[model samples]
Target: MTDRPDPFAAPFGSLFGDSMTQAELVDGTYSYSGSAQPMENFSLHPATHVLHYGSACFEGLKAHRQSNGTLALFRLDDHVERMRQSIGLLRMPVPDAALIRSLIIDAVEANADFTPDPPGSLYVRPTFIGTAPNIGAAAVPSDMGLLYVICSPVGDYFAGGIRPLTIYVETKVPRTTPQFGMVKSGANYVMALGPTLDAKRDHGADQVLFATADDITETGASNFFLIDDDRIITRQLDESFLHGVTRDSVITIAGDLGYSVEERPLSPSELADWAETGEVFLSGTAAVVAPVGTVIVEDSARTVRDGEPGPNTLRVRDALTTLLTGDADDPHGWRTTVSG
Candidate 1:
């Protein structure tokens, strides 16, 4: 690692590993050097299609420094698959799954030393951009692309570690265009930034829950959930939000830990009531399992379960962490051990 403040002390993803992996797609064929290379910048043309037409996408996953003193990537295959989907949606040629998997693995292996202790890990970001220089191709996808994987040593993604987050319920603006919600495109995040910033500035909230038309979907960055001692309820899989890998893990863990998991449409009205009786949370690759303390509905704050991290929320986060760190059995075959 470079000489800098601890990753835990810095904002998440501020410190990157020294090595990275990259590949290029041209004329529908992808090629690579077959290993992680020194991290570097790209020389792109002024008219790069991604810069003009927004043909770019990315995926976020992590490599944990496990309890056994080894590095293991959590849900590597799943993230690879999601990245492929994102690339395809951007009209870029999707690299073969094995190739994407190899790029991520090699990047983590090359930068394994930067993997931090428990509660911190190497954040893996795989990005793809349309490299064809054609400003006129605004309505068309680029023929050439660049795909790369980078690693950043990161601590808690949220500024406050494991603390209950205050969420602003935005029943007005949607998080993204409904059809493109599941694709991990940079455009989607940019679209949500205005509302997220407004929420933070106006309501002092950590995230904005997009519940357009009183129909609940997800936060700007994470999947929202309502849970208690008995059931875990979240919006069902649809074309309206990202289907998070961590969200799936939490559901499986919730079932394993004896909570009935419910995947269905949630509403703002229901959330208003659930806030009093249930614990609210958010899940994603970055957020992992995060508890929500307050939801600002119609500019009024509603406290969720005494405005603190509930036992069940902590249980879910701990179970997911243990699985990621190999402190517990990996029954679901989720962790991929990265060899040095």
Candidate 2:
């Protein structure tokens, strides 16, 4: 870690590892060297398909430095499957799951020396982009693509660590188009930029919680949650929002820890009511489990009960952290060990 800026001092995802693995898709076949090489930039044509047609998608996961001095990737297979789904959705040449998994592992192993301590980890990003130099093919899928994996040593996704966040609720604007919400594509994120920026500028919000037509879906980059002493509730899975891996992990862990899990439609009215009596949180790969302190609804600010991190939120977060760091038993078999 010498001769490098501290990850905690720099912004998350700003620092990169020394190596990367890349594979190219031509016609319908894929080719790779089966190992990581020196990290560098790619030279793409000005009229690349992805530049104009938005044929790009990405996945975010992490590799943790365990207590026993080894690195492990959490929910590696699930991330791989989701990335494949995203690529297929973009109408690009989807790579095999095994190839994606091997590339990720090899990249992680090549950068294993950069993995930070417990509070920090190596953020792994697998990206795919259409490479055909065709700006006219707006209605057609590109036949050539590039798939690559990179790693970044990150401290925390949020600026401050483990504190409650303030979110603004936008009932009129959605995070993204309903039909394409489930895909992990860059277009989906760009669509939410306006609302998120407006919320942050006008309402002093950390993020925007999008709930079009009074139906709550998710924040810009994470899933919403409502928790109490006996039950954990979130929105039902659909094509309207992302199905998060961290969200699934939280539900499963909570159910095993004796809380009733409910997946159904949630609304802002119900959330306001729950804020008076329950706890609210958000979950994602970047934000493992983030407590919601205040929600600005229709220009009216409402504080969650006591406006602080609740016990149940911390309990689940601690459990997830322990599992990620190999401090607890892997009963779910979700961790993948990456070795050189």
Q: Which model scores highest in lDDT? A: 2
Candidate 1 runs further than 4 Å off: 1-4
Q: Give the TM-score of candidate 1.
A: 0.98
Q: Considering summed lDDT, which 10 consecutive residues are worst modelled in model 2?
A: 86-95
Writing each residue's lDDT as its tens digit, candidate 1 over 1-340 gives 5665598998998889899999999999999999888998889999999998889899999999889888999999999999998888787788999999999999999999888898899999999999999999988899999999999999999986888899999988999998899899989999999999999999999999999988898898899889999999988998888988988999999999999999988888899999887899999888999999999999999999799999999999999999988999999999999885
**Model 2 whole-model lDDT (C-alpha atoms):** 0.93
Tell me the TM-score of model 2: 0.99
Range of the 10 consecutive residues with the lowest summed lDDT in candidate 1: 1-10
In candidate 2, what are the lDDT values of residues 245-288, reduced to their tens digit? 99999999999899999999998899998989799999998899
